[model samples]
Target: MWKPILLILLMIFIGVVGFHIIEGWPFLDCLYMTIITIFTVGFKEVKNLSPQGRIFTIFIILGGVGTAIFTLTKLGEILYEGGINRFLRRRKMEKKLKSLKNHYIICGHGRMGKTVRERLEEEKLPFVVVDNNEKKLLELKQTYRCLYIEGDAAQEEVLNKAGIKKAKGLAALLSSDADNLYLVLTVKLINPSLFVLSKAMDEEAERKILQVGANKVVSPYKLSGLKIAQGLIRPTLVDFMDLIIRRKELSLYMEEFTVKRDSDIVNRNLSECDIRRTTNVIVVAMKKPGEDIVFNPSPDIKVETGDTLLVLGDKEAIDHFEKSYLGGIS
Candidate 1:
C-alpha cells in the first residue's frame, strides 16, 4: 500500500515540476494542470502549452495514470480480501458461540480475567472471553486459541453475543469497579439465575457490586494482604495449600461432587460408601442444603440427596469415585 501510494505521489511531483520548467507556469497552475491531466478530468489547460510542454504532459499522463491505476487495484484487492476474511471469521465465531451451552462467560481480559480463564481452562471447563479491546482479544486468541467476543462486556448486545442466556455463570473482571458493577447488573437483568462473580478494588466497590447482583465479590488487594499475613504466621500451611491448589508437580486434586437423589450413596452413611478403600478419595467436607459446611465429616453422618461433598484425592481416584458412585460428570 505504501509503495504504491509513494509512487503516485512521486509521479505527481514530477508532473508539477515538469510543467513549471517546460511551460513557465506558476506552481498553482502547474499543480492544477498536472492533476487534471493525470486524472483525465478533461479540463482545459491552464495556459497554451509549448511543444516541449505538450511532450512533457503526455509522458506525465502515461506515468501518472498508470501509477493511479496500480494503486487503486492494490487498494481494492486489500479491501476485498480483508472484508471477506473478516466476514468468514465472524460467521465461524458466531456459529461456535451459538452451539455452546452451559458454558462460562469471562468479561474483560485483564489480570483477573486472565487468571479466571486460565483456572477454568485448567479445570477443563468450557468458557468464552469477552473484551472491548481488540488487540488484547487477538493476543489471547493467538496464545490460547480460545473463543472470545470483541465488544464492551457491560453491554447487553455483547453479552448476548457471548451466549449469556445459556451460560451457567459469568465473571466480571473489568479494569474498573464501575464497569464491573454495570456488567453484573446487566447480566442479572438478562439472566437472573446465572451466577455472577466479580472483582472489586475496595470494600465499597465490593458492597455495591454485591448489591447490584454479583453472587460473589473478590478484592485482589485484600486477598494479597491476607496471603502475605498468613505466610508470615503459617508458612508451612500456605506451602501445603499451594502444592495442592497450584497442582504444579503434585498429583493431588480437590474437587466437589453433588449427591444425586437417585444415587446409591444418598441414604447411606459415609463409612458405608467405603469411598476411601474403594476409590482412595477422602471426603474432606460436606455441605447440605441450607446448612453450613462440615469439615472432616464423620463417617457415621448420613448422606442425603442434594448434599455437596468436597473431596480430596488424585485425578484418577476422583474420576473413579464420581463415575462409580456419583453416576458421572455433572
Candidate 2:
C-alpha cells in the first residue's frame, strides 16, 4: 500500500520539476500542465510548446502515464486483497460462532473478563468474547487465538450474535454497574436458563444485578480486601489454598465429579467401592440431590445417583478415580 502511494508522489514530483525546467513556465502553470499530461485528461496546454518542450512533454507522457497506471493497478490489487481477506475472516468467524453450543459467553474483555476467559481456556472449555472495542477484539483474536465479536454487549442483538441462546453460561463484566445490570437482564430475556456471572462495584449494584437473573455477582474490591485480610490472619491456610488453586509447583488438585446413574458404584458405599485402593483419590465432600454438601463423608456413606463428589489428590489419580468409579463425568 505504501509502495504505490510513494510511487504516485514521486511521479508527481518528477513531472512538476521536468515541466518547470523544460517549459520555463510559472510554477502553478507547470503543475497544472503536469497533472493534465500525466492523467491524460485531454485538457489543452496552458501555453504553446517549443521543440524541446514538446519532446520533454512526450517523455513526461510515457513515464508519468505509465506510473499512474501502475499505481492504480497496485491500488486495485490492495483493495481487492484487503476486501477479500476481511470477507473471508468474517465468514470464518460467523461459521465458528454458529457451531458453538453449550459454550460460555464473555461480555467484556476487561480485567475480570480476561481472567474468566483464561480460566475457561485452561479448563478446555469453549467460549466467545464480546466487546465494543474493535482494536481490543483484534488484539485478543491474535494473542489468545480466541473468538470474539466487536459490539456492545448490553444490546440484545449483540448477545444473540454471541449465541446466548445456546450458551450454558455468560459472564457480564462490563465496565459499569448499569451496563452489567442491563446486560444481565438482556441475557435472561434471551435465555432464561443461562447461568450468568456478573461483576459489580458496590453492594447495591451486586444485589440489583443478582435480582436481574444473574446467578453470581463478584465485587473485585471486596474480594481483594477479604483476601488481604485472610492472608494476614492465616497465612499458612492462604498459602495452602494458593498451592492447590494454582497447581503450579504441586501436582495436587481438587476437582468435582457428578455421579451418573449407570456407574458401577452407584449403590455402593465408599468402602465397598474401595476408590482409595483403586485410584488414591480421597472424597473431600459429596452433595446428593436436594441435599446440602457433606464434607469429609464417612466411608460407610453410600454413593447414589445425582451425587456430586468433590475430591482432592494428584490430577492423574483424580482422573483415574473419575474413570473407574465416578462415571467419568467431570
Best by TM-score: 2
Displacement of the residue 100 alpha carbon in candidate 2, Å:
0.5
Per-residue lDDT of 1-330 in model 1, one digit per residue for the tens? 588878888888999898888888899999999999888899899899999998998898888888888988998878766786667766887789999989999999887788888888887888999998877787765554678988899888889989999999999999899999999999999999998999999899999999988989999999999999999999999899888888877899998887998787889999999999999999999999889999999999999999999999999999999988888867
Give the whole-model CA lDDT for all candidates, comma-separated: 0.89, 0.87
Using lDDT as the measure, which candidate wins? 1
Off by over 4 Å in 2: 1-3, 15-82, 135-138, 141-144, 289-291, 326-330
- lDDT (tens digit, per residue) of candidate 2 on 1-330: 898789878877887887788878888998898889989998999999889889988988998899899999999888876787667777888999999998999998887878888888887899999999776576775554788998999888888889888998898898899999999998898889888999899899999998989988999999989989999999999899888877777789998877888888899999998888889988899999878899999999999888989999997898788778856744
- In the order shown, what is each candidate's alpha-carbon RMSD? 5.9, 5.0
* Candidate 2: pairs in clash: none
Compared with the true structure, model 2 gives a TM-score of 0.75
